[model samples]
Target chain A: MAAPAILITAFVVIGGMATALAQSLGLFPLVGPPSLTVAAYAAQASDLPVGIGLSLAIAAASTVVACLVGFTAALVIVQGRWCGKLVAALGTLTVPVPHIVGAASVSLLLADSGLLARLFNAGGSWPELVGGPWWIGVVAEYGWKESAFVALVVTGTLATRAVSYDETAALLGAGRLSRLRHVLLPLSLPTLTVSATIIFVYSLGSYEVAWLLGRAYPEPLPVMALRLFNAATLTARPEAAAVAIVTTLLSFGAVAAALAYLRRSTLWR
Target chain B: MIPAVRVEGLSKSFPGTGAPVLDDVNLTVEARSCTALLGPSGAGKSTLLRAISGLERPDAGRVLVGGQDMAGVGPEHRGMAMVQQRPLLFPHLNVLDNVAFAGTVRGVAKRAARADAAGFLELVQLAGFGPRPVAALSGGQAQRVAIARALAARPAVLLLDEPFSALDPELRSVMHDLLAQLRRSVNPTVLMVTHDRSEAAAVAEKIALFSGGRMLQHDSVERMYSRPVSLEASRLMGGANEIPGTVRNGCHHSALGALRLPGDTTWPPGPGILLVRQESIEVGPGNGPGLHATVSGLRVLGPRRLVSVDAAGVLLRAEIPWGRALAAGDTVTLSIPTSALAVVDDPDTAHTFPGAEKRPQITVQGLATLASIDN
Candidate 1:
């Protein structure tokens, strides 16, 4: 690679690590006195388990749902005529939006006073269009967004994969569903994992969605940290910094572990 | 038993393509017979093979597995297996899962699928490779695994789209032997598409030549090569020496000299082109019972030699044995035997086909298999 590209990449990596370290050290002057201390760590440690649990539920559920839907969409597009074109046309529209934008859009569309409700009201419908607590939105958003992302990813990844296997599997007496379940799904899994993990990590650190559409109480990790930083006392800033560090570290850990597991699993070999 | 397959008027126009790649292609592949689709690069051989496997939808036509029309049958419903030119094994699956893929998808228990898949692995001569990663396989081994995977489903029809084109000649020959074994033992009907006439001739019981969006001819391998119905079929089958001749008194007089066609007595004297296979011309000395010619150059094809000679005024290529080496200036007698000539109305050639009078001193060697003769 050219020096500029390498330098740019290195700078991004260093910049991310530096910011993570600064946050962990409570260096921000706006909310608290800047210092490296173990007090923040101690205070946040009490809340870590719940936060981690919430993160896992959201991330894992989203990854699995996204992969199933995405891999299936990829198989259909690659194996089907009209459906493939339609999938291609609807690709990647929702994934790359800035976190704040994504969070706001989902909130506007699914919140009680949102467009969905307005549409329901216009129809004189009684049942709320999108209801329930954070769990519902967590599952619903991840399911909706990640599937499309996975679909796009799988399509690109499997472009070189042969259409002939469909034929061969058929010639071998495989029925339509069986061929997909047997030949197509298994074949697309490696790429499925890669794409799922990418969206998983995206979900892991995602703050905007949780802030906009997530429940106000029993706050998500990002929201919890945000509330701590906003406290009047300077003492709470270190604790908030500590929570941010832990959340960032958890995201890194999940991605790194998935990468390692993928390497050892013969998926890439 | 029902014939292995029957196809009629198969035609496909790719989305956005103005011309149909495959048009009105009719065929019957009998049970356990090996049939080859032969044509040049753009002759729609691949499209035809894909259509049979139900991988590609034809704009018009019918594909019958037995007596049933399979117009809307998807590939997975066709009970057929296909091998593409490049081996496209699932990178995510190990050899065991890759070969057993279809069976498992059909709800075969994993253990049973793996076991039956192992049997096919043995059939393709890769018995112990069940655990190997796809990337770890050699080119030849990967191709064999693809075959194993396809055959494991036990589909009655097997389609190969230039599958062996990437293999070295030696490996291709090995594949041929393996296919012959399948014909005898497994007894699957085979339909293969190839640009290589030599490979088609070697393995196929029947050959169908396609050109200009139509099947020029489909017949036994020998008949297709020796008695190609048109100039296109002849050209695709390695008849590079062509000459425009005038039919006079039921005898065609050409730049390659004169010859008689039994079927030409009814045609009025006008213009026609004579196609001569390279092997038809025997090169010797003197104008004794042949077209007068001179040695131009020669190419040595492994066991045989192709002697380039000038017959009359036209440059033509003829295959000769490697036993003797002729220099560039030697006077050579070129024979234009009646059986060696195919005449057609000169179509689209206006340079008076120097092919008749313009002799380029060139010889082709190494490609000297006569398997295409005597259908």
Candidate 2:
């Protein structure tokens, strides 16, 4: 049981250190012969400012939105009698619909001349709901997809905490909102933090939605990285590897921060 | 004002669960009175407390706090606070804030809430400890803080769910005394739920015994110990020496010789339980036929010796004073002080002392059947 976890952690540490060192020394077989260079590192760092900015913005926005959805879904499922069916429905749908399937389904549902256009157009020309005639398509895809992910993780966690803490708070004369704010929020922090960060990091690296929805000028980090990785002829491969390394680094950093947060937070205690 | 709480015909059954956890359960907690709800684990004392505090909605019953029906009123509105088995202090808040939570929720200003919370800190003897984090308080100190918090709300009814059972004996007594002081000072119509019979007897103005799912008896603590309504209640209240026999004519006879029974209006006597507490029986100098008993085992429990003996092939256990010395296998005369005979009517529920059917002779038995040992 412990072996796989130990092995996986060893792989992550060894893999991450090697990748970092290689990227530093410019030992890319695809790009060129083994060579140490400060220029490649400098360019990578300068590119990272913008990439990391977009990356952090998406992470923060998605995580906050997801935490709210999760908290709300949990409250409804725990306190409301009818929310069990919703949970059942969400649970059943979550497993079969892979990420690619979800991205495709969402796009199919929301794209112009798609189901949404049919609903709104009524024999009129397709409104600029997709293809970014305005900033509508990017916002629509990001909101819809991340919100679903948030609700999915939060529903289970919130339900358990709501049930556990609600009765106890009730006995102690804590009202619904007060209990949620004090007891539920603190007690469910470890799970909620982990869940939101999971959604946030996944959203940052998620390629399917960004590729299908975002345009070239303001391409999402992952999709832009994919574009950069493929078009590399020979010398640009190291730069591409550098972008991959940055994305991977972002995921690790977010997870590390969340773990640190969980340690300092009282819920686990 | 109809007492702080009056629960009548309070019955409830969950969807799939057939029997009601609380079945026609009735109890009244007078203002300024501390009543301990006593029962075995599934006895529904805690459930009853929840219903009174308006946590669990009772199916076919009414809970009125201070003459106001608490049908739709929330727990906060009812002025009822419960201290659970665990301290359940908020880690985010320092000691003052956690205790002040109830007052703040009741619309008190933050400064006033902290001031009021500080008042209880002194009351629970935690005055110097307010500014510290809640995590720093010890279990016993935290429990007192929880009590102080409950009292800070100035609740009309305070429900305690085995609040001190988690503490050691010394701390439990300290907490108990503190509770007694709180009840006297504030008169908040306290209701405590506990399975400890001794605790119930010690702390409650009245003790209600629950068994299986039904409340067997709810009476004053003295009455509950001295004259429990049923066999199970008596057994729960610690009636250790119960024996099976019959009543013939006017004399009550048993596996032991017949003695006089008392007049009891509760049960119409006919083959009933001869209940006696271990401390009630006095062991004296003998071999002169006080049921012809022989000691089997003896344990010296400071100031009290728990002497296990056998009489007439039936096993009886008694707790005698330190001065009353007897060894294993020693024959001694065990006298059932006439004041201690509590006759319960159902023999199947307990041991039937012979001749308890007609007249009123209470023949005390020795060690009961080993079968009743596990019970």
Candidate 3:
């Protein structure tokens, strides 16, 4: 019974990737006869390096921020008080808001003439957060949104798995900081890694947030791919597929690394 | 010297649970002495231990360690360590690191802490097992490691919350022996909680009895067995026979006829319950100047047989040696010395038995039979 569903999912995922690979290799084209060449990849090689680096930097920044904030939020949520409930409610509220909506809100709220700049009356000295060289707006949007996802997932693991050992550590004379370092971090490492991987991959491949918030000069992989895919030149389509393929490969590499690290963790075992 | 541990009027109740988990409990343990909180499950024994360890805050009263108040002290600062029922060893640490955790957390050098931990492992008979991961341990080995870990802290008070209840019978006995060795070598003031009466009596110099969130009695192990203060306490302490009667003129009058109360008893003239330890009641075939009864049931428990007898409709069970073969329907005379009797009054029936209510003649053989199932 499960075989059919598994097969269908495999076909959809693998078939889509195969089609993209074919297009990137110049074996399939929308406006010309089929042929094979590395022209599409070699054409964007210079831009490809910049795009991959930008995408990696953004995803790395977002994942680190999300994990740290989410881990702290998870600790608070597991404490089980009014404050915990408030944090939990806020996380729950954040998770369902679409990232596109989140990006729009972030752009509006952090732009030079946006809400905070107007409210604070500091329009002239505003930080240039949106459409800035630092890509601060894109990273912040991903961090804020994905932290809630990470928090909820990690809180579930901590509430059930870490509590008993946490108490045991306390009884063993581990103070607050020591308990956090020894018990909470080790116990929650696998969950944290898994959630962080999801956030990283999502940030790497998502285009709408970066496109809406990032400066046009050195775009992230997803934004550059979408731009090329929609350009007037038909030859740009293969370049777009090449960028997408690189993004997918990077995600798969990240997931494989995370799984390798988790497999060696004593707690994960 | 001040007691090593003192709990004064500690009370705790969970929100929305009207019945308190602990109610007006007070207890003390002398320096370097062991005390057991013996009671049924949910009797608040473990809760009291947690309160003393500072893992739990009581709604009323407080805990003192070595005559110092423990209010606002966290478990980490309490100079106390606890071994939970399931041997909750740190999964990320190997056995040596787990046992060395307390010292390492206190800034002891890792090598020094581990060397000290190896000695503790030896004390618990797990010396060579230090390199093994906690997950690789057997149930008994894991518990031994937990005990070693707690002891490596060199705590002022060691709290054990049914630490051996989860192990098999043979492993539990081994743990008990290790505990005895620890008491002799370390001699730390210890407070342990257990529902098994024998476990408490074997490990603790003093035993406190609790039921329904209230402490019923605290006494030495010998006195707790021979002189429980209430019928509830008597049953908890493993006494099987309860003869409902009234006390007047220092004599208890029941279906078995008037009997003299123990000289130490100071109960006033009132309806009372007479409790007799089955081990204290003697049964023989020869006639005697005691209650003449007939055996209604017999059970073999190792080298002893639990003989149930009915003396003029007052049912009683006696533990007798298995030398002479006894069977159901056999006639025997049962004698219980006045020194072996403990009479306690029921609060509701303090004044009367309600319109000349006759003593119920139901056999307590079922109670003895149920008690046997625990073994």
Clashes of each: 18, 18, 0
True contacts kept of each: 0.73, 0.42, 0.73
Off by over 4 Å in 1: A1-38, A41-48, A62-90, A122-132, A138-148, A162-168, B240-276, B285-293, B296-302, B308-316, B334-375
Question: lDDT (CA) for every model shown?
Answer: 0.74, 0.71, 0.88
Where is model 3 chain B poorest over a 10-residue stretch in terms of lDDT?
B350-359
Better of 1 and 3 by TM-score: 3
Error of 2 at A212 (Å): 0.5
What interface RMSD does each of the candidate structures achieve?
2.8, 2.7, 1.0
Off by over 4 Å in 3: B1-3, B245-271, B286-290, B300-303, B347-375
Task: Evaluate model 1: give its lDDT.
Answer: 0.74
Displacement of the residue A136 alpha carbon in candidate 1, Å:
2.7
TM-score (C-alpha) between model 2 and the true structure: 0.83
Query: What's the residue-level lDDT of A248 in candidate 1?
Result: 77
Report the first chain's TM-score for all candidates.
0.82, 0.80, 0.98
Top TM-score hit: 3
Arrange candidates by DockQ, descending. 3, 1, 2
TM-score of each: 0.83, 0.83, 0.93
Question: What lDDT tens digits, residue by residue, belong to model 1 across residues B1-375?
Answer: 425799898888877888889888888888888899887778898888877777778889989987778888777677678888887787767998889987787788899999999998999889899998899998889999988887887777888889899999999999988888876768788889888888999999999888757898888987676566666667667776766656777776654434786573365677676667888777766646666777878788888888876655567888878765588878877766666666677466434333523443222221111111111
